[model samples]
Target: MNLHKILIFSSCLFLLPYLNIVLFIEETTSNFYEKYMSMLLVCNFIFSVLFWHNPISKSIIHKIDGFFAKLSVVTVFLYVAFIKDVDPYNENIFFLLYLFFISFARLSNKHSRKEWCSNSHIFYHFLMHLSGIFGGIVAFL
Candidate 1:
């Protein structure tokens, strides 16, 4: 499939649970704050995926989204670190480093081919998957 189709498909896949979460929140809670926060999160998730289609790295929107991703990663680490007690405080540091690398990869897209090593795709996808899982768990709990 083409990149645009892949992006659209991925967005729809991510949106299912996202919408369910929002609907559940709306049904369970009356507070506008929580409701709006959940909506905002849904929007963020959609926009994050949309960033892949940005026209240029130098675009303001691209930089803003990059900053936003960094913010989300930090927020997830902090939530797990101090609030949820799901992981050690030191884990936040490691997460921050990982976030840095992700941002670097997204922003720079520069790295030696030698750096891929033997399990480059495996390791990269694994970490990406791990972060999403960690973030989801932290967000839910």
Candidate 2:
């Protein structure tokens, strides 16, 4: 199938994780603040994916969603490093973030303003979500 169809189909896949998060995550974390923030970050990601078809809204959505996205990663790192008193490096946070960096950089390239982007762009955004989910599962669970 085409990348556009693949991207939309992938968004539906995220819903499973989203439901899992909402249903089971509240009592898992020690900190309520962090738990809610992480949930919001995931929802933002799902919304960004759902709304990505709109060219005019793409940049705006990323601007809003991306802030929370980057913030969530950094916050997760900080929670691991200071609050949990563990070295984030031990968990390979940088390695996880590399995918995010590459994905964001590629998606934000000059071609991003167009109604559509290369297949790589769609794939990278999808990877971004996967990395986020994997990183969260590793760090939190």
Candidate 3:
């Protein structure tokens, strides 16, 4: 597909591990998800500022990313401001890597460096999910 589609599609792929983590964390406790949701907000804030003037990024993904990023920040604020306790490690770190992977993957595509990083991104993406299986075991046990 074209660049924009690739970015969005890649983003969707990048989101799978995150979604799984959300589900897995949900099973454990809402506080865990809230903590991670906070981290994602910080990540998104950095992403938006860094990519703000980037002409290469897809507008759709950029906008959606901004929305989610802001949502994450607000969610975390609300969680912390109201929630009694927040545990950082409840959600797997691999999920954070999942966000990094997707963002880098999209950025690489925007820069037309896909030939260099696409395969590696895909490889890491696959490995991250596989690691999630292991993480699930460790997390629940």
| Per-model lDDT | 0.47, 0.58, 0.44
Q: Higher TM-score: candidate 1 or 3?
A: 1
Summarize candidate 2's per-residue lDDT along 11-102 as a digit string, tens digits: 45544434555666666454664566557656655665656555234466657656766676677666665665445574667445655745
For 58-115, candidate 3 gives per-residue lDDT tens digits of: 5764666667654653453354335534246544353454455456545544544555
Assess candidate 3 and give its lDDT: 0.44
Model 1 residue 27 distance off true place after TM-score fit, in angstroms:
7.9
lDDT of 1 by residue, 46-137 (tens): 66567545424456765765575555556545554555434455465556655755654443333214432224432443345344534443
Residue-pair clash count for candidate 2: 0
- lDDT pick, better of 1 and 2: 2
Task: Name the TM-score of candidate 3.
Answer: 0.31
TM-score of 2: 0.61
Better of 2 and 3 by lDDT: 2
- How well does candidate 1 score on lDDT at residue 25? 46
Residue 88's lDDT within candidate 3 is: 62
Candidate closest to the true structure, highest lDDT: 2
Q: TM-scores for all candidates?
A: 0.49, 0.61, 0.31
